[model samples]
Target: MGTKIVAVYENGVLRPKKKLNLPAGTEVELIIRPSLKGLIKLFEGVEVKKDAESALNETRERKLWE
Candidate 1:
């Protein structure tokens, strides 16, 4: 997912954006780098969120801390 770069836009022009057959209400994350080619990368935020949520849930369930 980290390696996926969905779009590349430049100088008011947009590159070929990727196509996805996704379900509604899907959440995505974008990394925008304006200093270099206006580079942009899209990621599946759901995956990251799921991991974080599980991690937090586990800690809460066990009352553990580092």
Candidate 2:
């Protein structure tokens, strides 16, 4: 399982906003990515007639035989 935490980059180190459960000297991998709020705003003005759930169900039904 993987854990997700928000962190801030300071002078040089990345500081986690919350405390972690890991012990001292434990090595962990980091996957840095920006928030999606900004990306979502890019399509704010767009409109769609079909909801995601309905479209996903339609696609799944079509591929059921294959």
Candidate 3:
């Protein structure tokens, strides 16, 4: 298998399944099709969570994202 992507389904599974076979170190882009709930979940904590720079004390942590 070449970079197995976690398949997702809501009430019913999506069709058109395919397989991939590649050599070692073969990097590939994954086109994941997340369900509506799954897509919303990805933004759950991220959207509400405070920015690390604003939440973290300057003396307490070093932020790479800032």
Question: Which candidate leads the pack in lDDT?
Answer: 2
Tens-digit lDDT track of model 3 for 23-52? 778766666555666656744665435676
Off by over 4 Å in 2: 37-66
Extract clashing residue pairs from model 2.
none
> How does model 3 fare in lDDT?
0.52
| Reference-based lDDT, residue 42, model 2 | 44
In model 1, which runs have C-alpha deviations exceeding 4 angstroms?
1-3, 8-16, 34-66
TM-score on alpha carbons, each prediction: 0.29, 0.53, 0.24
Which candidate ranks first by TM-score, i.e. highest? Answer: 2
Q: Considering only N, C-alpha and C atoms within 3 Å, which residue pairs clash in candidate 1?
A: none
Could you give the candidate ranking by TM-score, starting with the highest? Answer: 2, 1, 3
User: Which is better, 2 or 3, measured by TM-score?
Assistant: 2
Tens-place lDDT per residue, model 2, 1-66, is 899998888899999989999999999999876556643664477555699897557646966322
Q: Which of the predicted structures, 1 or 2, would earn the higher lDDT when compared with the native?
A: 2
lDDT of 2 at 22: 98
Q: Would you list the rank order by lDDT, best first?
A: 2, 1, 3
